[model samples]
Target: MSLTSVFNIAGTGMSAQSTRLNTISSNIANAETVSSSIDQTYRARHPVFATVFQNAQGGNNGSLFADKDQSGAGVQVMGIVEDQSSLMARYEPNHPAANEAGYVYYPNVNVVEEMADMISASRAFQTNVEMMNTAKQMMQRVLTLGQ
Candidate 1:
């Protein structure tokens, strides 16, 4: 793939990871949020991504044992989805959001999971940045060779 294409691919990766990190931050920020009902609870969100492929004619390998054709370009974000898992319920009778049964519902987000996701997303973003930087350096080196 061309150096420019490498930059594009890494850029997409960085963007995707940024979205992931944002979602995780939202989740963690709302981890302790209490709600009067299930419908009012904050939902955890995640970003979806898809691969961009080019036909073999353009240079895409499209093979089982090899890297796919990245020359065509990078990837794209499909969407962000909310996790639909069950929310947590706790018995806090004096709480403002407590139900008739003294149970208050909270978001299903777990602090531990959110922390892990944050770390993972941050690392992925850094990796993409490094990849882009490496690609830039390689391109600069190639120019020096020509001069």
Candidate 2:
């Protein structure tokens, strides 16, 4: 890949991670929310990812031939999806949203899990930024060679 491809790769990575973080944030924010009905309750969401790849040619031999060219450009967010897991149910007769049976339905979002996911997403994003900086430094060094 060319030096310029680095920027494209890093940019895509950052964008993908940003989307992941957004979903995580939403999940965390709604973690404590309670509802009277299952239909109205919030569920934790997660971002799906896909890798963008370039067709690489086959490796070079002795005969005239194109080398295998294949590499990932970066990651992409396929979509954000709600967790299909069951929602949390608690018995709280004093709660406003409790049902006739004194049961309250809460969002499936687990604050601890969401917080961990946020940390992971943030670290991945920071790593991508670091990769871009390294790529930038390398490019700068190459330009310095022209001096």
Candidate 3:
């Protein structure tokens, strides 16, 4: 793969990680949100990502794996999916959002898990930035070869 491709791949990675971080932040922010009903409760959201690959002819074949004739393009955000797990129900009858059954529904978001995911996404973004910088440095060094 060419050094220029590295920049594109890393850029895509950074974008994907940014989306992930956004979802993580949203989950954390809504972790304490209360609702009178389960249907109105905020569910934890997570981003789904997929790898992009290009064939030898530079066309995407939608293949999951890159063979000898294929190269990895980068990561793509598939979509944001809500956690299917059960939401938290508390017996807070005095709460403003309490249901008729004296139970308040909270988001399924786990603050600790969200924090860990945030850190991981941040690291991934930083790694992508470092990769782009390294690619730039390599290109700069190649230019100095003729000096």
Candidate 4:
């Protein structure tokens, strides 16, 4: 609820978005990777996030008695999870990675989807930066008011 808290919240958002971008990059990088077997195929990874809430006592809202004024403090990265969808299996008999049955397994990552996610994550990170800058400017103006 304070100007200082804005910086913390925005910082956390930027961090989360950065993690998202990293996963998008990884997925895109492995999009064309082919494996000899399904078990060896790369799976698309995504970052999971959770919001951190602030309680009325200015601490984390982790207690049952916490007041209703539980505002979002920031974001946290829960974990990165691999997509459980089926891998792409293609019949590339001549390919080096082809299996004995003439099938090659490719990653489930979709380049277009990964690109879209990259753009979204980049925009979210930019937004967080702008928020932090706005909070900084506001704090500066408040300091100038006293002078």
Candidate 5:
């Protein structure tokens, strides 16, 4: 891989991590939200990521389906998916948002897990930033090779 491609790889990594962090924050924010109906409850959201690959042989290896010619390029966020787990139902008859059966539905978001994911995403983003900065320094030093 070329030195310039490092920038693209790191940029994509940062972008993916940013998306992950956003979803984690959203999930954490809605962790305590309560609703009368299950449908109205906020569901924990998670981002889906996929690795992007590029064909090294001019984008194709002269075959209809070429896997050997592909190389890892960067990461990409595919989409956001909601948690399928059941929502927390509390028998809080005194709550304002309680249902007719005296049950309040809370979101499926787990604050502890969300916080851990946030920390991981933050570190990944910082790592990507460091990688980009290192690439920039390397490129700059190459310019001083003749001096």
Candidate 6:
């Protein structure tokens, strides 16, 4: 792996963590939201990620002997998926959003879980930033070696 590729790998990690943080924020924001129907209730969203492999030949050059042992290039966001867990149903007869049966459907989002996820994503983002900074420092040191 080249020194420059470190930046790409860390950049992708930061991007993925950003997406994760966004989803956690959304989940936390809707944790207490109540809906009149199950269909309208908010479902906790999570972002899926996948490893992006670098082209063995590099830069699209069709080399006869491509390096097959090359490691991962970066990470990519697959998609955001909604949780399939059941929504919370509460008996609030006087609530305006309650259904005919006096039941109000709450979002499936769990505040505690969302908060934990937020913390984890934030830590991951910080780690990626640190990795990028370290790579930059290493490159700078390399440049000074010949001086």
Best by lDDT: 4
Cα lDDT listed for each candidate? 0.81, 0.83, 0.89, 0.90, 0.89, 0.88
Candidate 2 matches the true fold with a TM-score of 0.87
Clash tally, candidates in order? 1, 9, 0, 0, 0, 0
What lDDT tens digits, residue by residue, belong to model 2 across residues 51-123? 8775423323232322444477678888888899999999999999998899899998878888888899899
- RMSD to truth, every model: 3.5, 3.8, 3.4, 3.0, 3.2, 2.5
Residue-pair clashes, model 3:
0
Which is the winner by lDDT between candidate 2 and candidate 3?
3
What would the C-alpha RMSD of candidate 1 be, to one decimal place? 3.5
TM-score for each of the candidates = 0.85, 0.87, 0.91, 0.92, 0.91, 0.91
Model 4: residues with Cα > 4 Å off, grouped in runs: 56-66
Q: Look at candidate 6 and tell me the lDDT of residue 58.
A: 58
**Per-residue accuracy of model 6 over 1-147 as CA lDDT, tens digit each:** 688989999999999999999889888888889998999889999999998876732552343444654477899999999999998999999999999999999988878878888889999999999999999999999999999
Error of 3 at 140 (Å): 0.2
Query: Could you say which candidate leads in TM-score?
Result: 4
lDDT of 3 by residue, 1-147 (tens): 678989989999999999999999889888888999989999999999988876634765554554545677898999999999999899999998898899999999989889999999999999999999999999999999999
User: 2 or 4, which is superior by TM-score?
Assistant: 4
Q: On lDDT, who's better, 5 or 6?
A: 5
Task: Residues 12-127, candidate 5: write the lDDT tens digits.
Answer: 99999999998998898888999999999999999999988866325643445566456668998989999999999999999999999999999998898889989999999999
- Runs in model 2 deviating more than 4 A are 56-69
Clashing pairs in 2: 56-68, 56-69, 56-70, 57-67, 57-68, 57-69, 58-67, 58-68, 59-68
In angstroms, the error of model 4 at 102 is 0.1
Ranking by lDDT: 4, 5, 3, 6, 2, 1
Q: Write the per-residue lDDT of candidate 1 for residues 72-133, one digit (tens) a residue.
A: 45667899999999998999999988989999988888889889888888998899899989
